[model samples]
Target: MQRVLIRSIFKLSNQHATKPYLLQQHQQEARINSISCYYCVYSSKRGQQENDGWGKSKRHFISLLTLGIGLGGIGTAYILAKEVSALEKTATNNDTHENWHKERRTDLPTYKQEQITKHDTLEKRVWVTYGVGVYDITEFIPKHPGSDKIMLGAGSAIDPFWHIYQQHNNKEILTLLESYRIGNLDKADEVSTEDMGSPWGNEPKRHPLLKPASERPFNAEPPLSLLAENFLTPNEFFYVRNHLPVPVIDAEGYELDIEIEESDTTRSFTLEEIKKLPKVTVTAAVMCGGNRRSEMTEVKPVKGLSWSGGAVGNAKWSGAKLRDILLAMGVESDEKRHVIFEGCDLDPTSHPYGASIPLSKAMDERGDVILAYEMNGETINRDHGFPLRAIVPGTVGARNVKWLSRIIISDSESSSHWQQNDYKGFSPSTDWDTVDFTKSPAIQAMPVTSAICSPSQGEKVQIVNGCINVKGYAWSGGGRRIVRVDLTSDGGETWHVAELEQEDLPDGRHYGWSLWSAKLPVPSGCKQVEIWSKAVDSAYNTQPESFKYTWNLRGVLSNAYHRVKVEIE
Candidate 1:
């Protein structure tokens, strides 16, 4: 069999040396894993090194089995293949084929349906990139979690581009794309030639079965493990907080119009130019101001997404400095007091939109503000932001606008109800009947906040004397690194300084959330362990227990100390 394999390899090599077989067409790379498949390690090269002829038979049999399992026949495969080819042709065409665009391509499977089938959707809801080139919407470019970086391969499949950089959006990426006009797209006659791997290959199979997202979760309560990691959250696990419907933009005609009040001037930066700036990246968390709104439901019915402390996410954001770009545009501040940003998502009000930050926060050093273009070393996810978005460290989440468009440098705050009427903390007694939006300022830098990320609040533990591991995350506002995390096992009486991971952990160690661990000596004869934790910000702002004093009609600034309980053996 081994000799036969060698002879067969030589024969195939001789035939290839004499006549060129149809070459595999390359597609734009949208993610890292795509690159691995392109450099196939299990191909004829390896087969030749082993069983030559017999190994070739074995491989052919496997390929046949795979194709059978993937699609019922070669015909369905060809139809799927043709659509991918058309998308590439559309991208490379030099003429305006906007008329050629006959349907909403996005509605089609994001990647080939076969790739989606590879994953066991019967269990978990992993991100399924099911199509050819990534959907590029130029108008929506600036509003991505990674901001303009999503437009990196504006006129081609993004699959090829994502493989080049482990950290791309972090650098100036104007040259990210060779060109942007899709009308001149080159024609491709086939779908990608890479073989699909196991759908459930990398994910863990032990966790409780995850129901389809469209179906309601088994429990609306937030999971404990989610809050432990502060950065680079797994794309699937990142908390989602959407205020309005996500907008889909057309990449070819997308334009960002900045109406400069002074000089009565309007300058436009195509999705391409915005990405050309010297790329920079910062690590921060975008936590909703009312992160724990569901907790407030106990006091009074709140009027917002019933979020259980899970509406925040942390990530390494890479893009241009919004301040640098504004300076280059010759934006004369004229003593501008604030810079208001408007996103595409809005409600039914006359101009229902989003909020803003002060000029100092918007354009300061510690602010580390960015017009983000990438997340987790890839272009922003469609759900997060596809084009442009703001990244403010330690600030409440409402200010991070997705689907970004306009930039207004003004002296006053945003007129959006979100800015003036919400996200402000007030006395616990304050309610709809007696509260005033003007009574408080827009919430900015978050107070020292910490949460128990394990051992669900009322979790039952095996009554062993083994150490009960206590884990959580800590953060402070205004670029203040989490200086310390104090864990009190006896409800604030006896305290232990927990161990914290300052850098990257094996899981989500750095770039987003700071992790803390406490090894409590499982006490003797204790039926329950009352756990409490607090953090001190750079400014030494500590969380006041209970939202009694931190409450507002809008339920903002709910940074109360997180407490949990567990039973002993």
Candidate 2:
């Protein structure tokens, strides 16, 4: 029995380090401990039975106990150390990109494709080469955190940003970007490392159409008129609001780790593994919580990205259901309150992008939340989360996190700064000095909103037969449908019912926008026309007539009636 117990300890030690090298070292320690235990037990028992040698037996017993305890302790410690080292090695090997080209360069594109891929304006074919690799980035241009700054590399090399943005130098970014890899750049055309000096010097080219908010962590929106041109906003024209520089992820190495609150086990899923699950496609609109914030500044100079009405877009997304994945991962149906999502993108301050949604909303069969890999029928581009992203339909854009890396089912909300300190609403009396974020809940489902896209602010319009045409988009959150759109040529005194263009969707499932147009007669002999538009939803939600009563310190949820003035010269 004693020998069997010692053998069991040795067997346990072997389990700690399964790697051949570490296992060998651990086995050697186990053998020594086993030998010592056997000799000590055998000698101590034999000495106890000899009555005439009592004095010597006492000394033997004492020594036997010390040797057995000390050697057992040493063996246990060595086994633990080896186990930890093995775990560290696994993480290191998974993330390293050394010799990446030699191992994963099979499907790259040629030099001719790189040159012809430039000029995305017509064919909408955007490609860029980085370190002898080519990537198609057309889908990412509009959703890019820097907006059109990404366009500067269209049909060209990414060397300019690579040299200037020090963050892109790491292996994680190189691996993350591999998911978008289509082909290889010809060796001769690839920029040599010696010649790839920082030419732009941290300054990226700004998009001509975007109104600059801040130059460094680029923030901008397209001109208001261009935003209303299409029901589905073009990717390039979509407004971008970013809190950090974008992160590149190796598509092959990407994993979405889910922490099951019940089991306390973090299970990992690859992008391909997620793709194989049952697919769900949703058409939804994602609008920034700060969309139309610039108008709120008119009430008071509030602090935030200066955005107009252009900060929203509708897209079709395809991916595995978040609810399905969570259930399959063994999370108890009743265990969580909020489902927290974390993105791989990190700020210099070491904060990863994060948000949380109510568990009720996340698990609702009709909620349509997904771990999306494809946007608009194509694989998601790198700038917008190449391998995977979370699409929470009809929610604020911030909650629809990009570069998603983790899904946590928990009883409490996320502790992220974005969730705790920002994106919440405040009363009209609230000011920066006296405001408390905890007093108000975070802004979720956006309020009923509409924006005038045509006859842009301060434009001249020709009155043909005393009539002027007006057009724009209207949408509401919480699955509410836009029931009516009112257009006014004379500032709400007399309203014209605009004809709404929309798809025939099921009842209680309207999540996209409605493009409306109306031909309203110009007031007799007026030199200028003031056009105002507001939409009414099925729930009777409508925009405020003025922004003054609704203005808050953070400049959020600006849903006032959209007004544009045009001269009738």
Of the candidates shown, which would achieve the greatest lDDT relative to the real structure?
Answer: 2
- How much does each candidate deviate from the true structure in C-alpha RMSD? 20.8, 23.6
362-478, model 2: which lDDT tens digit per residue? 787788889999877888765456578888887888788877877888888887666776688788887644566667887678899999888888888888888898888898887
| TM-scores for the candidates | 0.59, 0.64
| Per-prediction tally of clashes | 58, 10
Please give, for residues 324-418, the per-residue lDDT of candidate 1 as tens digits: 87777676443457778776432211122457787776556445678777886788764566677777666777778765666677668887656
lDDT of 1 at 110: 29
Residue 557 alpha-carbon offset, candidate 1, angstroms? 0.8
How accurate locally is residue 127 in candidate 2, as Cα lDDT from 0 to 100? Answer: 65
- The reply for model 1, stretches above 4 Å from the true place, is 1-222, 229-231, 299-301, 332-336, 349-352, 463-466, 503-512
Off by over 4 Å in 2: 1-208, 332-336
Would you list the clashing residue pairs of candidate 2? 108-183, 108-184, 109-183, 109-184, 118-155, 142-235, 175-249, 175-250, 176-249, 176-250
For all candidates in order, the CA lDDT equals 0.49, 0.62
**Which 10 successive residues of model 2 have the least lDDT summed?**
59-68
